[model samples]
Target: MGLSSPTEIVATDKVEVAFKNLDAAILVGSMPRREGMERKDLLKANMAIFETQGTALEKYAKKAVKVLVVGNPANTNCLIAMKSAPSIPKENFSCLTRLDHNRARSQVAMRCNVPATHVKNVIIWGDHLSKQYPDVHHCKVNVSGGEVACFDAVKDEAWLKGDFITNKSWKIVEGLPIDDFSKAKMEATATELIDERDTAMEFLAKK
Candidate 1:
């Protein structure tokens, strides 16, 4: 079945007008970073926005609603949102770290001359900032016959940690326009929640 188009709801200060009966909510609104501005620089402004939204979510959203914070300083913003909404489980709130994870996978695949889908287990650790580490030490890439460590396939630590982390050419990626990057990040965040749900189901089944 074809998916129904999402209804758009614009609200000011209060999300109650829009958040009613929400199953999932993705918070992507925040002050955009200007050139030369660091993610940390956005912390205060974004936290204020998140705090207000979080209160609104607590007032209007379903208690089980999952929230993904995609704004700048995402990690801290997510924490602020979660704290503001004490009714929601902390696990239900997450920052959009999947974008960094996907970037790490794509970079590993490019360096190894393999498809991005072939790369697995690339971990994005720490804050979602410049200091974030995309470690491929445990990642595996599908080879001609078997899986091999991505780090072993691409024996350049500098490229993996430095260039790969900094060089996300936002112009063209596999013929897709850079304008879709925002959508891609949102999709990645959604995918993370789906995976989380699946894991929870698996654990429950094993109990």
Candidate 2:
């Protein structure tokens, strides 16, 4: 037994035309956040996009379909999508915060001089924006014998709360090669990160 053939590729800006029988939907489209723009500034601009997508997903996608919103101002965008898709279960919709999660993990690993894989439970709290908190207070990392608290390994609270957590997710995207700053490249990068995080989650679920 092999898996079935691929589904049809519907390329359309119209959400009604594209969403149909989807088992999982990853929303990576939204208006880009410009310099000096706050997350709330994007709320009105991106709300319509998520509303249309949400409505389409509600009507067309499988009832159990999982939705991961990767758009800018993701937390609020996800809230709009969820509200728009009232027919779908609330738990099925989530904002993609894994990029922040991975950033925290990598920073911890680098500080501890261990591979990123050795880090775990670097919790990301609040929104997916700059104000979000990446708390490693209860996180653990692999050691010679077993695992130990990440905070214990790196006691520099000022660095963790200030530079480590705040510098990565949004800034890294802004620092992408100027030529590669198009919508396509940014969407592709977000999609790749979502895929990687999903794979890791699936692996952990099985374990």
Candidate 3:
């Protein structure tokens, strides 16, 4: 999943080739990619892997529509991927902040005791980590037959940037109660249709 492997490379090729006919392709990775190798070496390890895969996408998946990095060191990994895929438009390379945004929306909605839809749109900006600014600004919603605004709850740009900086760090899930939780969750989630009625839609599309 990190770098080039026979099966992964083959699958990547198949996807790229298939998508070329459809006019676009997407590449996703599970871990963050970073800029440098460090003393602890963990960050560098993922970066190396991402760099290699990015190169592969650049070379073989030239026609891809978008490259979305959801992995840790997301921004760095995105940068690495984009760097590798010179053929792909840089604007097509984006890191996923939807999950973080979802968290923000859900939290606010629950706080207001409403479904997430009522919160309208929640934007998670910055690095996509805790430091990420879950700017609820510009968000609107219908609640209790009236409009309730909470975006202003976050205040301003400084608060958002400060929030992002304050929370940027490695994320690790623990106490899963089982060793297989990671893979199991991923497999299960990946298999589920994101849009129940539209099976062709991305399993995690925001829409």
Candidate 4:
């Protein structure tokens, strides 16, 4: 290995060792599912894992550590980890939204027949879960004809407002809206990491 490499990989299977003295904790890997495991069982199983990880972070990691949970049911896992680490500031804990963030942009880009880069101001509102919403009310598409509203370009509420996963039972979930407009836009759209796209799979398959 080059001595000047910016980062080094110190792979380990020990959770205690991994959660300690870190600048940032990204809990992305999930425990492999067992046969006949129900959905709730799976959630509980991961919850236990994150709970332990969170406790360790509190006890040993820097008080300023930032955490991002990206495992399955990331929102719940995010909640479990945040609640577990009381000493750690609440704002420091978050779930991965890049997947969904890019998705909302892609959908807008496709609908407008432009590159994904042309889509802007799209926000993923609500908990980063299946029921999480992709809000485009404020989204803008940079078409040749200057900028156009996403709704005007797509013109299909059915395509834009599609079914997503997870229960919307909690008063709080991923992507909380900051205002009445955002709140309504959040309510209007509905979603999940569950990007099964071949490119996403390829990235996950990499070391």
Candidate 5:
């Protein structure tokens, strides 16, 4: 994957004066979740920070600048950022789905007893946090002899349907079968996103 620049600007509040005409903006700064903080709390805390950065991007960054939100609560934060920047095309915005992708990849790799590089095609569905679903049904691993379906390797039906860590890189993956359990998880993720969007709009209204 083509990685973004390491020149990170920690000063989210100073985006206006710090730079201009940016080609790609990797908004990685976020508040850490302290002891006993819920995911919703984390999401609410980062909303204002991303809102400011998104506004700055709209005013100063290039029209086609690709914005990647790498913080926790990334999906909701990305939504807030994208909504804040009306001029920037929505397709130009995204969140940290790579973590979900990599997490799924690692789990599959460990299951197959192969290096992570040997695993591919693990799909992360919906949000980037608790609501995310890592679908390995279509995944494959490069075993000693040859490649095999991830399910053939794991062979644990109950574990396959169990909870695991998550992203939504939906373009490269499509048309896969979704069982009832998977559907429920994906729907829950979507509902959570909708709630977050509504809350974000309300928060923005007060600003």
Candidate 6:
């Protein structure tokens, strides 16, 4: 028997282990082949890509793999992909909300004069884009290890309805020239990572 025979078996077993341990998958799409796109339009474009990817996963990957859609119009894109692959559970698909959550946490921490860690169980719900509802209603911030309801007194219905929505929702336009060309150029460094790695596949395949 060859000395390397057992090593081959171990390598194969590790592959199986990796496939087994995969809990969920994330799918990202390249830029849609369109201009002047709305959220719905963007979602429509990405859905075509996600649909294919979702089908591939259902056919080739492990059963019961959760899917997270990181592309724009994420929630709708997720829904479209989920529908495309009926074999994969619908609940298994979701959109990324961590960015909004982080932003909210940072804002809250700054407002309340507490470290970000002091914020407990911050829930970011609904559509991942501008339409998302950052419900700080249930969130509690710790000050000196004391828990306090952050949004308890914010009962002004008119202000909450109009002002909050207007302030929270904004258009994030990139590729615009700001005075700080150095910072913008530095930001462009992310393109290399995008070039090298399939971030969508990595997220989906990660344990």
Instruction: Say which candidate scores most in TM-score.
Output: 5
After aligning candidate 1 to the native by TM-score, how far in Å is the CA of 39 from where it should be? 6.3
Q: Every model's Cα RMSD, please?
A: 13.2, 14.1, 16.4, 9.5, 4.2, 14.4
Model 2 global lDDT (CA atoms, 0 to 1): 0.69
Task: State the RMSD for candidate 3.
Answer: 16.4
Question: What digit string (tens of lDDT, one per residue) describes model 4 on residues 1-207?
Answer: 111124766666665666667887788866655798865566666767877788888887889998888785666677777777899999888876677878778767776789999888876665444457777777888889589888787778666766322212112345644667556555544222333222233332341
- Could you tally the backbone clashes for each prediction? 0, 0, 6, 7, 0, 2
Q: lDDT values of the candidates?
A: 0.67, 0.69, 0.52, 0.67, 0.76, 0.55
Clashing pairs in 3: 25-65, 31-71, 32-71, 32-72, 131-164, 131-167
lDDT: worst 10-residue window of model 3: 195-204
Report the lDDT tens digits of candidate 6 across residue range 48-144.
5776666666665557777778775455566656766788766677777676777777666776777887776555445443445555555778877
lDDT for each residue of candidate 2 in 4-72, tens digit (9 for 90 to 100): 237645466655556767788889988987799764445556776877788888898888988989986
- Supply candidate 4's per-residue lDDT for 126: 56
Q: By lDDT, is 3 or 6 better?
A: 6
Model 4: how far residue 107 lies from native, Å: 1.9
lDDT accuracy of residue 140 in candidate 6: 78
Clashes of 6: 2
Best by lDDT: 5
Candidate 6, pairs of clashing residues = 25-204, 26-204
TM-scores of all candidate predictions against the true structure: 0.68, 0.71, 0.56, 0.70, 0.83, 0.60
Which stretches in model 4 have alpha-carbon errors above 4 Å?
A: 1-5, 31-37, 127-130, 162-207
Q: Rank the candidates by lDDT, best first.
A: 5, 2, 1, 4, 6, 3
User: Which parts of model 5 are misplaced by more than 4 Å?
Assistant: 1-13, 38-40, 163-174
Q: Residues 42-63, candidate 3: write the lDDT tens digits.
A: 4355556566666667666646
What TM-score does prediction 2 earn?
Answer: 0.71
In model 1, the worst 10-residue window by lDDT is: 169-178
How much is 165 displaced in model 3, in angstroms?
11
